[model samples]
Target: MPSKSSARLAALTVAAACSAATTLVLVSPAHAAAVRIHDVQGTTRTSPYAGQKVTDVAGIVTGVRTYGSSKGFWIQDPNPDDDPATSEGVFVFTSSTPKVGLGDSVTVSGTVSEFVPGGTTSGNQSVTEITKPTVTVLSSGNAVPAATVIDARSVPAAYAPAGDPAANNSVNGLPLQPSTYALDHYESLEGMNVQVADTRVVTATDPYTELWVTVKPRENASRRGGTVYGSYDAQNTGRLQIQSLGRTADFPVANVGDVLEGTTAGPLDYNQFGGYTLVANQLGTLRSAGLERESTEKQKNGELAVATYNVENLDPSDATFEAHASAIVNNLKSPDIVSLEEIQDNNGATDDGTVAADVTVNKLIDAIVAAGGPRYDWRSIDPADDTDGGEPGGNIRQVFLFNPERVSFTDRAGGDATTAVGVQRLRGKAALTVSPGRIDPADTAWKSSRKPLVGEFVFRGRTVIVIANHFNSKGGDQGLTSHYQPPVRSSETQRHQQATLVNAFVKDVLDTQKNADVIALGDINDFEFSGTAQILEGDGELWSAIKSLPRSERYTYDYQGNQQVLDQILVSPSIRRGCDFEYDSVHINSEFHDQISDHDPQVLRFHP
Candidate 1:
């Protein structure tokens, strides 16, 4: 036998010769070669004979894994043209710049090599290494160039789920795919800029920095056994970051009928407080394409109109206001008075240096103008000035915006005004007094926690006491217990307390104004079936404006794999008569929550 050194030298010589031959084959002037991701074959594509200098390979990213402190990601290309049952011929190792996700179609090019694969305890196929593969994403639309945007819902069952986890409970009826890849992948994208599109519903818009958007893959796609599905929660949902561009002095900076576009770079991640969700990073507007305009004809009759939606956090920023102003004005059924939650204020002052309280109020006023509606002159009880606790910038509360053209500003009431039952422990409390003269109390049920902003609005011929509530969250089980409470230990004993307080207030208001119509709306923070909601409905006197419709039409928030009825528009029997309230839980926030705000708005349209 030859000496050890001599043997090694011989092996090297053989490898060098093989490499040279491979180079010649690739450099030949006469032969032009290309390989589709689906066509590559063999059990192991190793260097020398295995390391072919393929120019390009096209296929969808079936799987992806990241390792080595953001060094790069490993992508799997399981092409249909390849061995279907086994991922044998698919590319095992591909280098990326850390912005790739599963189901994305891409074309990669570079010299392929073989090395030992990592992260496996069992001894398996050890081939790895793809040198300098230039990746070109093939997603559709100009949002991300070269990236192939897949519907994800269009992916096969083996790769994507057909319906949400809660709905179908499997990958097209099969067991749910392990979320190991999603969890890890989300961690990698945290704070990084990314974009996603899907048809889910939005839930919450608190803690303004990170907006949570939930998406639910359609169910029909799964029943057909051709598509895959995913659910929304802290994990798998997509996310977008909220950011502001400069202000414009135009009448309608961006109308409700304009498509919003923008880009930013930062880590993107997912968290599951109660649902799987996507959080965006470095979000900003790219452009606004005008959408189809709705007929602006106002209803001839005087009716009590109500609507609800997750505005994705209408912050006190000019760019955000402009981008969404038109949609809020036009897409909405043009209700006489609009009940809004998640109206944010700047820190201590408005962007223009006005008092933060005044700044927040004015930003909304300006947004109404941009949306092509009459000026929204309104008021809130608290000035959003409390800085000791609660959400930063005391201005992060629910507010009512009314079109002065339809309703006049009469008297303001509610918010910190009453020391009623369970109201002492609450910190930021107050209610706005509006025209038509109605009294609303800060929903004292969540006094120990984040109190609900409640107020009464007097319409043309009726008194509508509207309670805007932000109740105990379903993020954790804390709200489920009878003694559950927040830090202050106020009246938030259980999730139901928030609803209970609202129920009591509504009952009291109805008792006082027996013939008056009461409309309650806002982010209740709990689902429809929960005990908290039962209190508000009390003996069927209060009706869920959306429940009168089909099951598929009742959801206002998407959680985990199930769509839960969180945000709602509850109306007393008095208002339900002449007011055929049309309520729509718009899915806009579901698509862009991570970038905008988490909670969707609830709009009520009815004859006053």
Candidate 2:
């Protein structure tokens, strides 16, 4: 509930906007009959009357976006039709800034259009719009329509469209069940007045002045302040985006678990970024979730700990060394051997011909020692130029950092760039001829990506084979917010093959040594329920260590309002059979604005 002062503030703001709107009256002939905004918007992402000339489209101006190349005002029909499937509001593109006022009831004449925000090359969907208009102010001071309540109880529990969640499946064209599916629920409310109360913030406010929240907290949610993104099969459907349309200052900077305590009333919209967004102006007061940073348990003697971390492109230019060291040492507990992804070459993002990471690794190792961690030794093969995907010239690739005081790295001869290491069955046990060798480097699955780097390590006089990897990222995949009925995921094709090749290699090692004590870990860039994970865990030969934890607790990253897993560790059957392992996601990063990296490192502690 708003205080009298706050309520007075809201009234004053609305009054001020109406006063401004009253001053910008324009007169035009009302020769043609008026058309409702919903008729022009139709029921689809594109307007049914696009490219056609429409006259006398009348609505109250809801907002005026004066900045940006796509300057426009959103207009809504005060007397909306009884169709829940159609949008009552539409954006009127004025291209050049126009003298428009909020709450001004005006009659407009323009060519109906379907305008893409970033244009066609960007693959962004189009917005229903009225362009090249003739405007006439019909009236002023008319009350805005009441907001539709969209609280947690109002949202459907089921997210993602039913049937085939992927694009072009047999059931992709099935009719939407708006009452049950969240995608349909949001789509039905697109471009309409919608509001949510007492919502819990799900993601940190991003650079785009947008943040996600769950209107109603999921049941039995931990005091942790965030909700599980669940698996790919069961995405968090309760999430909603609140985007600031009037001012960036209006949107608060928040972390996962923070609460937006007041009501946010605005027009619902569909865009390229996220599926549905509430374009807001008068947002509610924020409530603190009281979440704190956490660190994992320390690794003790005889308990070998292995971990994976994505350093978020650390380089000499970025002054994140000590902070990263603190996270690795104090937070992640300084595992005996850690597989590091995205270790950049010297000079970082500079596209010079330099491929050496000696200085970069040296600085990080020095930072670790300075931060009371072990003096670590590292191993890696820098990628060819910018062939490895990441910041240009960063030469990002998988690297191994081992605490020599606790473990020894096996560095035999004959391993280099572009050389693939084959598994040898020596005395019925899997062994690599050369240590720190790439797996199937020449294979197409690893083209233009970081190839798996396998190495042997002796911990407490027992040898174990570990493979480090960073698979191709999900860059070009259409977002969940796509206007398409079911979103496309074209990025998975390559990853599926990459998984197959990796799985085959793992099987070879298992067949040679049934209890190989093998561990394959890094940022796989796919969900646990995804096909990529399925292939990697083929025939129960390898098991994802993160799965060892409760389903609700398995997350290494936070996106939107859902805590999800993007980093994972898969160990061989021998390790799973023993059941002596314990895994921790180490919530040192993510869920916070000030963190060392974007990803939370995962650790698996066990005796091999």
Candidate 3:
């Protein structure tokens, strides 16, 4: 089925592989002389002899991927060529159980091909491979190539290739310079043995049998465990993913700031999920950086504890309610008031028109009570039809759950799901015209988004206006593994608008009462140091409560190897100046694979 162009190219490729570099050998008219493994895999991402046949390519087998669609083995020359612009190793795609062993010295003939993971439409990097290989066992138990040190100096300062839509494949047709860009550096070492040493763990081990570490420290490093993710900077360059797919044991769970004191020897791999990975056979010592899952302490007398949690779209029919309730009771220490986001409708993803989450909230409250927690009363406004964005027909919205045993919801007249709550000054205090009312629901910023829900809660003879929010997610933003150098964040524009509206509401409250105990808390869906969070903390009207903790310990979420903050509780200036606040980013989730929710609930205890 090979076409004329492909067949001719394959014939020439076979001839090149047939020729030996420094040995007398039989030369076939149909075959080019066997070439070095480096000749086929030039410095460029795409091979020089792609679509052509290559034969007699001799090397020692370095790795084997005998499972999944990528069933193949990697081979590398024991002694590399002098030119650094060429790779001495290449993957031979068998597409089935490979006959080669780990240390077999073999000669192979196959068609050189470039395989784009996720297809060409994804715009990810393509893997150069030898397909449909014919192998000749030359020897067995041969020595493998030494692993190249992957220290700070080995990695370039730059993070990604310069181009649009992520990976800039081929660098706009320019020749690759492996020493300049980090992408080029990984490309040059593709399929070769590599080692990383004296690294810090950024992401914990996930169910996929992988973890992330930074071989070199990056800019804006947090004090203890977190990594401050700022604008499109090259901060993630030193980070590398480590997939222990070939390991005989399960990968250990690690928190951020953990140290790996020893060397991890593995072959460099580039795949679809992450960019460059070290497929280590044995991971080094994981030094505990004194970071672990923390249970927040209970509130003190006169201090009302308020918490916010994104339940990851909790529904009445979902099976995670019990676990979530248990976490709230045992880990979060039963806050007096809790802001719950992503509360779906009763049917949950059925696409029906039923938008009411009364059944859903009741079940969660009942579960909490059954799990040895407080008797809770919840409040929220249902979205119009399917206007809210989430799982289709799920109508995920925000809800406020207050412990009636300690606090009460002050509901006023004239409020509905479609009506916006009016802010009024009542007796030298800010009061919502209607309790559990929607905030500017008709605004375009909240179009197809979960509108902010404002509730007035009376605790210990004092009232506080709590605004719960579930802003637009960071789904559309390009990932850190993106190929584009310093990836672009396209979701900030809308989130900025959302933050502005929320900040305006807080300012209105402050105008009514300079010391108004207004706490805007929920899933902000951005980091504490992000522009969105900064905008919400405008002119000292409201301060992010997470900032009360030491920078080294301020994190509620973990992603891509970095302990981060996404859920925050922003309070008024009076609350921060009073300095009687205890904020805890409950570490019950995010780092564990068996988590009921992807996020950890945050509790802020203060005198209101």
Candidate 4:
């Protein structure tokens, strides 16, 4: 004899508890079980578990979105475990909650429910409730002592058993088991906390900002052979400041080539280019610490060296700027003149200021200095008042960084100073002066939006010309209005027009400086097989440095799971020989969508 209202309330509570328990059982046991955002699509079991209750899921907050008047916030869970097939999901709304930013590791519990598609759905599935969502602070711990550092070469290969009895007895002088064994049997220890010790063969340390230490694994250790990761924020140079905890403590620091011990609490986050990165929350010293510096010679004449990178927008933030700058000064193949793209200008800056504000030019200089690159100097043109009508988007653009000691600019062209290039272009070009130079300013055989930045440099007594070009982006077009709009032919038209201009410019360079050593490099925003690229390479005026290699190794960018050649360095035949120009399309940006920029960088090296 219970009242109807009371009975209904009790029934709902029981259903919620049952649902939560069921979800927990279905989720994998390796980590906490939770609902993911990607999976919420259709049915409760199929879609991303919206309007369903889940428990014990762990992940880093990739993104956060808030609605009007403190209605709620959607937390994006980017845990690898939260696959679409699994229930661990996102779109968990919190009512009247504050706000959460990106990169925060959090754990949430709540009823998995569907959000109203366009805010129009019925039933409990429309908006689920998170009765007891809890977030735990997990960034503070003891710094791993420095004595345990290991090197990549010291660790032994992993082995599994082979099925053949006669062959299983011994493999590579080691005892084999009954089943087939893998030489590299290390996979599971990705995101777990562990301590490592080894020698550092390579050290990329930017002064007071970040340090990347690569240690070879110790021999016969239980862990697999690989590199160990260690990093320290410059703001916390003398201490460890865990971003999650918002607290700081005195911690030990280690230098490059220093044998040290350190603890890594989680799995190495692999970059798009197959680099295993360890995000360190704590670092300390061990016994018998010492440094080993090797003497290196400066670049001699006649060496064809060039550097290229995406720069990931080259933002002004301390962490991002330092990380990218360090990589350019250290991690790259070390070119003489670096052609860079995606250099950004602050929204309201009238001039290119310090790296802390206007990152496009100043930050590159700062980063080079931090990486101990004192021999390098650079120059750039700010597009603030350029008559070429400004770039399409008005934020991100391209620039260049060079080593003045190695090559000097004899003539400079392009930029906002004068619209030598047309108005439709985004990034203005420049022609630098160099030794063994071959630039003739009087030549007007080129047609471009933003004029091509061309320059001449001396290498091994031979003069070569370098042209840095950034064509119109495929982001939007005249009639299309916006990217999300349909009827996309307008975008195609603009891209085609941009390509035509680029092709004409390339032809013009070759026509003016016949048989001259020249290279065309930058983000073209077009694939190799596309019409734009074809036109540029028309009549064999330009040849792809990558296509010269095996077909299997020609991709420079990956988008939507499709790999394409967007960024390239095309070399004229004059510099193709004796100057075996090779391109290494760094796979850093395209692999991880979270990379600072959306494009992977292309590097070219020529040995004369």
Candidate 5:
């Protein structure tokens, strides 16, 4: 979708034509038939003619991308092929800036190659390309091919077809079924010019100059305009990423539920970040729908309000402390207990073996008091230098911020990063041996992850057990748009192990006291319906309170247009049986352009 320099076009054409003639003379007559763009693309993810040279393939230049590291021009055959499984368009990758301009009728002679965007290890589908090409420009100013219209009707409801079992459950070798599967439909039109009209934005525009829009306006629609990822089966196939081919200053800043007015057309591209993207040559007008953040209600006199917020590697150096203070004071109404995740050391990200976070934690607490909130005190144990896996050298860990006026923290001696906490029976009740202590820190499940912090608190003559956790993140997992059908979630293996250890710890406390009040809350880093959540909620030991909301509202994070839950607060059987609790997924961030954090904080209010 970008244009190239026309000054060197004539010279490159002369040189390419000579190279083509010499290359063709060495080939025999058996494989000299004229090849089309569809033949180079073939019916599968990889081209059938990969590594083979084809001569005199004619097509009109639809788009010329002259920018970025991968500079290339897109060409589509004006002539039609009857097969829908094959794409008629392919990219001609020039090592540097392309010499050809838009609408140039050219015959390309090049070796067909399948280029994987993030290498083969990324498990991404390969993009068919013509590399080291020789070009012959027949004419200029030709009419470009008609852009294919992609709408709700064109995209299939099913996300993808099951992969073949014989090929390690990969869909790479399977013939594309454009009419049956949505991924296949996009694969069939990989490099072709496609258009969408009047689509609704499902994700806010980020600093990366990209946003997501949904063609099917009603697919898993949430009240706040994001597409809810309720289950693994439905991935909301209509969500597509859009990036402008023009100047970045000309790109529109949009939020969820906003409307992209009129038609926007571009060449369909596959990349490492988002699977399929539309590099728009003609962008649509952005119309704001006026989406706003949400606030939760204040807790009653006897009810205790608890919340969990991932401040996204917060340190004293960040400018978002005041904004986060306002969120706790105004949006959350100053909860009694706040489990804060990703609290970094004093000098953030400068790994010099400093692990204490008093400077960072006190700054946030001071900001909260300045925002007309409570005078809060914090409790946390600094992990061994670089033991917790987060922004390296920052030594990120979980900390509990409690209002002394509302609740009291019961602190005992001898709690550290390496020592394991134990449950004790004292005065016919379950209590933590060390108030703020790690749970199974020596376990292999928590090798480089944050250990769950166990603490005891008292409110209205009742003692309560609280566990703050920041589990292993989903870093190395394959995305939903992977070449392997039903992509492998390798990151979940560690999260599952972490969940099992936490579940055992909770079970230990419950076994000591049957009616103890337990609240396990923080960024779990997995979906509610995922295997990690199931292990955490083992045998009625805990219940995810986020599921208390409707199916549309059970999300705390937004990634690539899918609003899913990576943070959760699971209560014990005593809290679940009473049904005297309220849960809220406060939408202060994750849906806005100017966000302090990428996750929305969750709140739970109940009486002990």
Candidate 6:
């Protein structure tokens, strides 16, 4: 049964579709009769009437956003066309506070334009909008248009179809296939009011008052209620990012497993950071799922527990030292050897030729001891100032934190920032030329990126070689919602080269001693299934320990809404062939609101 407001809104919609009488009279003599909102938003991503002036475009204002840099109101025509490829709603960019209120019937005169968020070179789809609008309120207090429902059935299973080769493999020129692909399905509803009911949160509420929810709750569901990104082809299409038009202080603080338990209605928008986002006008109440952090079992006396944690450019003055200390002590259970990445210089980003990190490493060490953990000592090669690519002047590099009581660091001094480490036969066993030395530091593959730090250690009676790495990030890659189909990942070229160098270095150690115990662990900055990982596991010389876990539990980092693997631990055949190792992706920070770091730590236990 439709309420009175619904019935009135339906009638108004039919009338608007049947007649453009109100707009035709106000149209200038130079132009033809006024066009509807759908006509301005053509079947393609770009509007056909772009850069042309449109007069007397009529619709009922559904939302009024008085804040933000792009202040505007969303207007939806009550009368909609039969084509699902066209949207009935469009944003009127007022450039100031909108005078029209919600439910006010208005006619606007403006220039039709396609606004590409974050500039045109960003590879994002353009948003169709009416800019510099002149509004004329025809009437007040009319019912707003009904919102289109989006659910599991409405969105397609496939991500997108193959793009036309003539258009350089970009999907921008193709017509919308609303029922065939999820990207097209969302594109068909761009700028229109849509609703999602009983959505499950895949990404926790971030610091910017944004979160992500999935319409399909059961689609590749992980044990912790996150969408598992196991492969590149199986992109979880039901995931949608959410931002609020209401007060930021009142927005809900939610975790990954929480549920938005009612109808959340909003206008679908296309942006640069995230592709298709729902800017919610009516946000749903949060329902907690009681998600908790994870902890791993302690290692035995004979077993060596090695771990990797990216401290996210940690310095001495940061307030998260105590939290990071607690995470290392409590969540990770204080592994025997921890490879810590992103340890900044003394002053941390103050560009004054400062390249040392003793202060930062000592601060973290002191904090760990204060948190009731073992007295850990650190070793690292200080990178040249501003040479490694991270926060400028931060001089971020890898540091090894070892518990002297459990393991002994084999320190053969003479390692510097540019000196490359080599393998040698020391007393009929494989040994490093210089402990805590950089691997192929002069190679171009490591240009402006952190080089791998190789160190030698003796756990019980056998020697172990460990390499710590932090490869180049995916900064310039096109997003999933990009206009180009099969988004290009330009960042892989350097990472592939980086992986090749590290793999060759491991081969050198094995060539010296066939059964040499070698473990390479840190933030690989690529997927376990990616080519980068395959290169690291070249010809079965090394095997990734992350594969030991089930497909659903392999993620150590969460981005957008997909929980994927970025950090990894790969060991030689000597360690992996035995199949006696234990691996755990400790979930301490990534899934929480008050996170100390953006990545989860990974630990591996093996007998050396």
Error of 6 at 380 (Å): 0.2
Q: What lDDT score is found at residue 340 in candidate 1? A: 65
lDDT of 3 by residue, 452-540 (tens): 99999998888888999998888656556544445556778888999999999889888888878899989888888789998999988
Ranking by lDDT: 5, 6, 3, 2, 1, 4
lDDT of each: 0.42, 0.77, 0.77, 0.41, 0.88, 0.87
**TM-score of each candidate structure, all chains considered together:** 0.50, 0.90, 0.83, 0.45, 0.94, 0.94
Candidate 5 to truth, TM = 0.94
Worst 10-residue lDDT window for candidate 3 reads: 15-24
Model 1 misplaced regions, further than 4 Å: 1-298, 309-313, 348-356, 383-391, 412-449, 477-494, 558-564, 577-579, 592-595
Using TM-score as the yardstick, the better of models 4 and 5 is 5
The whole-model C-alpha lDDT of candidate 2 against the native structure comes to 0.77
* Model 5 accuracy (lDDT, Cα): 0.88
User: What does candidate 1 score on TM?
Assistant: 0.50
lDDT of 6 by residue, 487-565 (tens): 8899999999999999999999999999999999999999999999999999988889999989988898878889899
Between candidates 1 and 5, the TM-score winner:
5
The residue-level lDDT of candidate 5 at 489 comes to: 91
lDDT of candidate 5 over 229-274, digit per residue (tens)? 9888887999999987789899889888898999888889887767
lDDT of 1 by residue, 39-99 (tens): 3333212223356777655544433334222123333343233232222223333332335
Q: Which parts of model 4 are misplaced by more than 4 Å?
A: 1-301, 346-360, 385-395, 412-416, 421-451, 476-490, 577-579, 592-594
Q: Model 6 Cα displacement at 568 (Å)?
A: 0.6
